[model samples]
Target: MSATQTRTGSCLCEANKFTVKGDPMLFVVCHCMNCKKQTGTAFMSNVMFKEENVDITGCQDVGQYADSNNKSGSTILRHFCNKCGSTMFGKPDETRKTGVVYIPSVLIDGSDAWTPTKEVFAEKKCSFVKELVINSPQ
Candidate 1:
């Protein structure tokens, strides 16, 4: 773990808040159809941390929506703020070795470290968006 172990974030309406301890496992920009539709953007950037390292508060205002199963049969859980409808994160159904916690870049405070390590579903990326030169899962 890095010397800086804590990071903070809040929902657009300030109704949901959370703190994440430890450094992120990985960062990614997803260009899948589900992410594009959910975020209304070319892609969605997420920072992955360990679930145990995250402390969440004000979850009563959090809302969850899941997209249809993907080709890999993984269910994607989209978490957002019900009060202001700000999308906050995506949680995959698959259990990760580190117990992943995915947080959206827009809701993160320490965004300086949010540089994406890879892109996913690059084939689905918008034509208007320039191709990102990063490792991709295809």
Candidate 2:
């Protein structure tokens, strides 16, 4: 078996915990309407890891909801903590074959390492929010 790379994360209430391994294939900031509604913010920062490299413990206490759809016509799976209602992660159905896992920055201990390389749906970004040098998907 391949050795798993480990990165620790937790939910707002600390009720849910997880460890993600392997290099993230894509790191992005989503500014789509669905992302704004789900996060209640201008955008969502996400780091995609291979599902096989993720080991989630304490997830039994977590709540999952299927909300919205992606451009690929796939359902988005959102996982959060029931107690605190913290938005944890979003799973895009299109990347299921690659074991893709989207991890929210809030859960990460050292989130500075996961800076977004690009932004999606910038056309709908909040007017008050200024983006950095990250490229936006047209």
Candidate 2: stretches off by over 4 Å = 1-5, 69-71, 93-98, 135-138
Local distance difference test, each candidate:
0.76, 0.74
**lDDT per residue, candidate 1, 16-135, as tens digits?**
888887667787888887777777888888788777777776466887886646665666777988889888866775542337878887686877655678888888888998966554
Choose the strongest candidate by lDDT: 1
Best candidate, TM-score-wise? 1
Q: Which residue pairs clash within candidate 1?
A: none
Per-residue accuracy of model 2 over 1-138 as CA lDDT, tens digit each: 133556678887788888877556677888888878878988888877777777776576777887646565667888888888888776765645556788876687766765577788888889998856663334
Per-residue lDDT, model 1, residue 18, is 85
**Candidate 1 regions off by >4 Å?**
1-4, 94-98, 133-138
